[model samples]
Target: MATIFKTDAGNYKALVRKSGWPTTTKTFRTSRDAKDWARRIEDEMVRGVYIQRSGAERMTLEMALKRYLTEISPTKKPTTQRAEATKAQQLISHLGKYSMAALSAELIASYRDKRLASVTSRGKTTSNNTVRLELALLSHLFTVAIQEWGLGLSFNPVLNIRKPSAGQGRDRRLSAEEERCLLKAVNDHSNPMLGWIVRIALETGMRSSEITSLRRHQVDMKKRVARLSDTKNDSARTVPLSKWATETFEAALNNPIRPIDCDLVFFGEPGKDGKRRAYNFNKTWGVLKKKLGMADLRFHDLRHEAVSRLVEGGLSDQEVSAISGHKSMQMLKRYTHLRAEDLVGKLDMLTREH
Candidate 1:
């Protein structure tokens, strides 16, 4: 049974008390509304499908995102943590005022459409992949709220919405003349670390984060292997160093000006907090590329160039993935863009052998 009575403030209040269930109360502007709400609650209770939505109604998206950043983001990798924090800000700015209960699939779909239509700070339209990743973060937060945080959400709104397509992978390969100019410019820069980092990427096909976050002890010159324990995929791998790569490592290791307190292979200047972090050469790299007339060439393309070279050198697909730390053959194939000029040499050799 339920009680619907007029309140002292000229509003109607509905109260429901049932056996084997917690008491629930809600204030409504009209007596009819109060009775209607009470009847729904009673019907749901009888059907054994009642769920208290008070918590979801009170908790806003802003509050949930902050909690997630504090409790969940720290458990991810440093790169992932940073990326999630940025994505959280974007979500918070747009949909933070909406309570969890108020966020419907239609509302989330509107956000998706708006984000796809908006331009980024970089003066380009936001990519579909960027929107997809943002939605993915939102979806995960809702899942965590339901399963772990006990927020009592009936279903994830984000799951009900369509995600943007994952755009095509970049097939940007460096040309020979461009590579020569890039190397010369980096080698001649005031900061020698920039040159060594570029050479290492070209030689070992290591990710920028992997190459920059290296410690001296991780590299073994005698074994000619650079051991990576904190990789992007959370799988440890040992990258075999080429003769050229070994020489570059030796030079960087034996740098006379290197601070004794810094253990990072590529150490930057001390920060305001007096911490010597990894070398941040993004600004420098950007300037160098612009000067060399290769403004479109990205640093990751260097890794692609190296992987393609490995494949062209007669290394098997498995062999290339092992070196590049790629988890799947499909992903490895995306990076291996073989040049037509290189294939012509193979064709000529086949004719001679026959």
Candidate 2:
């Protein structure tokens, strides 16, 4: 039932009371408007489609993102948590003042466009993947708010919005010439560990983080296997070492310059506090890339190169996925691209057999 009253301020106030639902009240200039609002609200309640959006209307996107970071981000892996926190900060800077109730698909689309057009300090436009990741974070935030936090959002605005295409996954594999150039550059660098790291990544398909964070105890020289206790997927797996990788590890273990404080296989000299930290090769890698004229090459591409080699070696997808630590076969396929020239040999072999 709805009750309409003439308030002292000469406004018509309408109130709708239902047994199972919260009471909804609104003020309008005319009784017709008040009645219409009451009728629409009651009808929605009866159809079980009405969501109480008071909390969403009260809380801004900034507050919700902050709360999510504190409550949920810690549960994720450290690398993932850092990236999510950075995205959350970007969203807060753009849409922070907007209430959850005020966020619409139009607004989210507009934000997407804005981010796509924005350039970084390096003068490069933000990649489509970056925009897509931002939307994913925003979508998850709405989901948590609606399902767990009870923020009263009816739907995720990001769901209704179109996301920028992530574009094709990078299929950039190093040429033999490029590999020779890179190896020479790295070997001539000041740090001896840089060449070793590059070799391990190319041979074992290990991520840079995994190689850098490897502990001495995790290496089994007898078995020629390295045990990874903490991986990106949060699952433990063993990576077989190549003959070269095993030899490098053996030499590194026997190196007199190895740090004693840190258990990490690749660590820097002790600071004033006498604590050794994981070696950071960002500056060194950059300088080497410039020197080799391979500025576009990324360290992660080594993993791609390794996976592609495994695929070209006639390994099944399942076998390659095990070495690459890819949880999904689809993801493993993305990294296992074979060059057209390499495939030519297989095609010729098939023709000869025929």
Candidate 3:
């Protein structure tokens, strides 16, 4: 039985047939629309096509997380699944008792205010961006559940939330003097690999992961090439080695640690595994740059420096892309920031044309 009523706000409503789940109700802008909704509800019940609505609408955030962990998280990769678990934990711990269906613009706004005001595990004040990322992560999980898991959620309240913009990208590069200083000052005690890492990074524009994971067998000293097997984006590329890079290979090979590990190129520590010892290089890099008062520089900027040099060496976009493994010209353009001073000869051609 369907009972029709008019709301105090003048919206028409209908109480559709009570099913096994909570009594299904339909609200409509018009009486005819309400009647149509009631008819559809009854038809779904009769046909046995109506699945039970998620108890999530009636349950807390914690309840949803427990369900996801036991029922779904097992199917994902370990790292990815762990990240999802962490996101769920954050939500459960913070908004544990909050019902998903009851989430509104104002409630989310209040949550953002609380998260931003709270201190993080790092004991630092939480920024708007941090809060925004957490909220966005939660929003994405809801989307995944509704779309991927067939949760049948009709509304996503997160759609109303605003995201904070990631601030300006760091434009860091080693100046000529700073580069010389870094090369000259590096020693075994103070990041012996930094000078070599810096140079190879500048020469090849290979990602840090690719360079750190390079093996002795992958290098062809005579051919001056290193074959990287399936790097980021599952890309297999051969980086042409410069003369300095070839010599660096020889030096590493001559060292007693080279071939004993079979294919491991850069060992983490003397006896440790090469694969496990892959360096992030930030700590040593920070100290070295601080010594020279160039603390603003980042180690990854070496790749940018390498690309800049490649552009200056008169390599076209295609040529540079092949060596550096850049997928598109637009990506390469970001690193090709040449100053007017560096374009002296090119500007002379413009004067001649004028």
Can you write out model 3's per-residue Cα lDDT over 2-116, one digit (the tens) per residue? 7889998899888866656447775679999988877777777778776434444666667767777777778765555677777677677778788766667678777877776
TM-score of each: 0.94, 0.90, 0.69
**Would you list the clashing residue pairs of candidate 2?**
none
lDDT tens digits, residue span 1-354, model 2? 889999999999999999999887778999999999889888999999988777898899999999989998989988899999999989999999999999999999999999999999999999999999999999999999999999778888899988898688889899999999888877777787898888888889999999998899999999999999889898889998889989988876776787556688889767799788778898889877887788988999999999999899898988888888899987887888899998898899999999
Cα lDDT computed for each candidate against the true fold: 0.93, 0.89, 0.72
C-alpha lDDT of residue 210 in model 2:
92
Reference-based TM-score, model 2: 0.90
Clashes of each: 0, 0, 0
**Candidate 1 residue-wise lDDT, 215-259, digit = tens:** 999999999999999899999999999999999999999988899
- Arrange candidates by TM-score, descending: 1, 2, 3
Model 1 is weakest, by summed lDDT over 10 consecutive residues, at 166-175
Model 2 lDDT, full chain set:
0.89
Best by lDDT: 1
Candidate 3 minimal-lDDT segment of 10 residues: 270-279
